[model samples]
Target chain A: MPTIIFNRPDNRSERVDASAGDSVMQVATTHGVDEIVAECGGNAMCATCHVYVDEGWIARLAPMSEEEDELLHGVAAERLPNSRLSCQIKITPELDGLVVRLPDRQI
Target chain B: MSASGFTPSAGVPHMDIDPFSIEFFEDPHPAHEVLREAGPVVWFDKWKVYGVARHAEVHAVLNDPLTFCSSRGVGLSDFAKEKAWRPQSIILEADPPEHARTRAVLSRVLSPTVMKQLRGSFVAAAESRVEALLAKGSFDAIADLAEAYPLSVFPDALGLKPEGRENLLPYASLVFNSFGPPNQLRQDAIERSAPHQAYVAEQCQRENLAPGGFGDCIHARADAGDITAAEAPLLVRSLLSAGLDTTVNGIGAAVYCLARFPDQWARLRSDPTLARNAFEEAVRFESPVQTFFRTTTRDVEISGSRIGEGEKILMFLAAANRDPRRWDRPDEYDVTRKTSGHVGYGSGIHMCVGQLVARLEGEAVLSALAKRVSAIEITGPATRRFNNTLRGLESLPVSIKAA
Candidate 1:
């Protein structure tokens, strides 16, 4: 199991133990974490599961797909360099100590 | 004149099919094949609009709203030039910046927290409906199960008055039909839809909506300056126009699927938690929202063809869902397949806002059935309900054995 820290919109930091193959969005949704919406249910279609990776953890993640990049442009919040769609980020062992901050809102 | 004020590109492959015709509506798969094989962007000579049927092209057009705008209207008639059938949806028809404001407010109003609160009542309603249907054993799945469950629970959740609640279905039908050319279907729908449309408009008013319902919450947002007070009713109207029919068809699709594939039903019965995935797979297999229009903002090239600005491009969402280029076995209804990327809920900024609600309803009904029903078998041939855009069965005769 990989431990991921979710920095919620309400400023609460909750640590979740996630399975290696599950996406961060899946873990958050299954664990009842309020920060991620996952509106499209892990499809790279909706930008509702947006998260900002901490600077230190950004290098370990996979590259964004064209679909993910296009959807990110539609996010309600401003898209920062670290902004990523949580649905596209699979929880691998290398990402065991990932830290992601949820956007205030995801439409 | 091209609605976008540009000249039409010459030599685009022409197909003289009326996508809204009774024939096409009854069995659209053949027509869908024609659209896909014709070209990436073919000209519908009958409707004089460009049509895109391939999955990749449809996805591209939906993703690029700046080049293919929704502000003109997501239907055959461009709102910029023609008088709208009703007030335009501030959320659906508007582009970003303007669209962002209303969407943000609505997203919060329909957030997961709110939906979670609705789960208990919705699930109870589903269980009760399933209980009743199982007792009858052999019944019309559409009328007795699909339509009944949504009518029983959704309107009450919206805080609508019980008296004229039947109007929502016809109103939604009219709205969807208006997206196609003004054919006989559109004409008939328009005539029969007036009373229902009037009733929906009346219910959208602030005083008419029940306190503490979704409608009331939208009005409260207006008071807080999230959206204008004038826009509140229209947003409520948006919910009324879209919410019910999609879910009804979705549930209908689920039952139709399980009855058609007995083994899948058995799989669901063994693991009732697969209920949500079952509904989603059905959506992918039988896309309820078949098509929507997008207009070109400027000349853009897609699939080796240059499309001129202001052209009405009809994106076949259902066709795209089944396009071979996308899925391994696009037509199969496999509940375990990862169906996340399907356009059953249209992609991009204008994706269906009520999808979560629809999924919740489907999950509730299917979960109840899986827990209580051991098997679902089709007792008779399912009859199709022909709408211009939605694909659903009017009656599904199913016999279920109680677990």
Candidate 2:
């Protein structure tokens, strides 16, 4: 299991222990974490699950798909180098302590 | 080649069928086969537009909205070139930045927290409706269950006045029909839609909406400077346009599926938690929202075919959901399948905003029924509701055996 830390917009931190195959968005949705909206239900269609990955974990995460990148271009919040649709990031044991900061809002 | 010697950009096929015809609406699978098999992108000669039917192409087009913009319009009559029948949707018809603002307000207003608060009331309403219908033994599923549940709950949630609430369906039907070509279907819908359309517009005014309702919340956002006051009513209209009809048809699709496939009903009955998946599978198997048009922003290549700038590209959402290249045994109505990626709800930025409400309503009704009903059997042939875009049963006669 990988432990994912979600730093909320309100500065609250919630740690979720997720299995390898479950995406970060799925873990947030399943555990009722309010930070990630997952509006398209992790389809990478809507950018509601936008998050900023800690610089250290960025390289460890899987590469973003073209579809995911295009969707990121439309995120309501400002797009950053580490900005990612949380749905695009699958949990892995090697990246056990991944940190993601939820945007102020995911439109 | 067209009369102008405009052959589809190299290898892109042309189709002459009227996708809005009653025959096509009744049974679209064959036409879907033709569209998907013709090419990834095909020109609809009748409407002088291009269409994409394969899942991959449809998915790609939806994700890449910059190439296929919705701001001009997501219907046959482009707002840029034609007179809009009504004020365009602030959310659905706009591109990024403008779209992002309205969408953010809506997403925040209808967030999971709101859904959680709405659940108890929605479930209570669903249980009551089911109880009443069960007492009848046999009934029209569309009117008795599907239409009845959403009509009761969604409107109340919006804090709409009970009077003239019947206008929602006709108004929605007209809105969806307007997305297709200006044919007999759209004309007829327009003629019958005047009064209902007026009623919908009137209800969107700030004074008409109740305090603490969804519509009021949208108005509040305007007051808060998040969105302009002028944009407020249109956003409310967007909700009125996008919310009800799809869910009614969605529930109808689910009931129709469960009745037609009793084994699936049994599967749902055995594990009542499959209620949401069952509703989603129903959406996949019998897509309620059949099609939406997207115009090309510039000449673009899709699947090795070039579509010219400003050309309309009709994305067959329903057809894409059932595309064989995407789903194995796509036609089968199986509740247990992992239906995460289906395009039943249109994909990308313009996806159905009220889907969570629809899902909650579907789960509420299906869960209540699954717990109380052992079987759902069709008593008569289901009659199709003809619409330019939406596909659903007008009447589904069924008899349920109580659990």
Best candidate according to DockQ: 1
Candidate 1 docking band: incorrect
Provide the RMSD of all predictions against the true structure, rounded to 1 decimal.
7.3, 7.1
Show model 2 residue runs off by greater than 4 Å: A1-85, A88-107, B1-7
* Candidate no. 2 TM-score: 0.84
State the lDDT of candidate 1 residue by residue for B1-403, as single tens digits: 4544333466568788988888888888889988898888888777778889999999999888889989888888887679887778898889976987887666666655577689899999999999998889889999999999999988888889889887888899888888888888788888887798889989999998889898999999999998889999999999999999989999999999998888888888888878888998899888999999998888788888878777889999999989998888887888776666688898878888787788889999999999998878888989998888888999988888899
The ten-residue window of minimal lDDT in model 2 chain B covers B1-10
lDDT of 1 at B151: 92
Clashes of 2: 0
Global lDDT of each candidate: 0.85, 0.85
lDDT of 2 at A64: 88
- Scored by TM-score, the top model is 2
TM per candidate, chain B: 0.96, 0.97
Q: Write the per-residue lDDT of candidate 2 for residues A16-105, one digit (tens) a residue.
A: 899998888888877767657664666555577899999998988889876577667767688999999888887878879899998997
TM-score on alpha carbons, each prediction: 0.83, 0.84
Q: Per-residue lDDT of A13-75 in model 1, one digit per residue for the tens?
A: 999999999999989887877667665866454577889999999988999975577667667
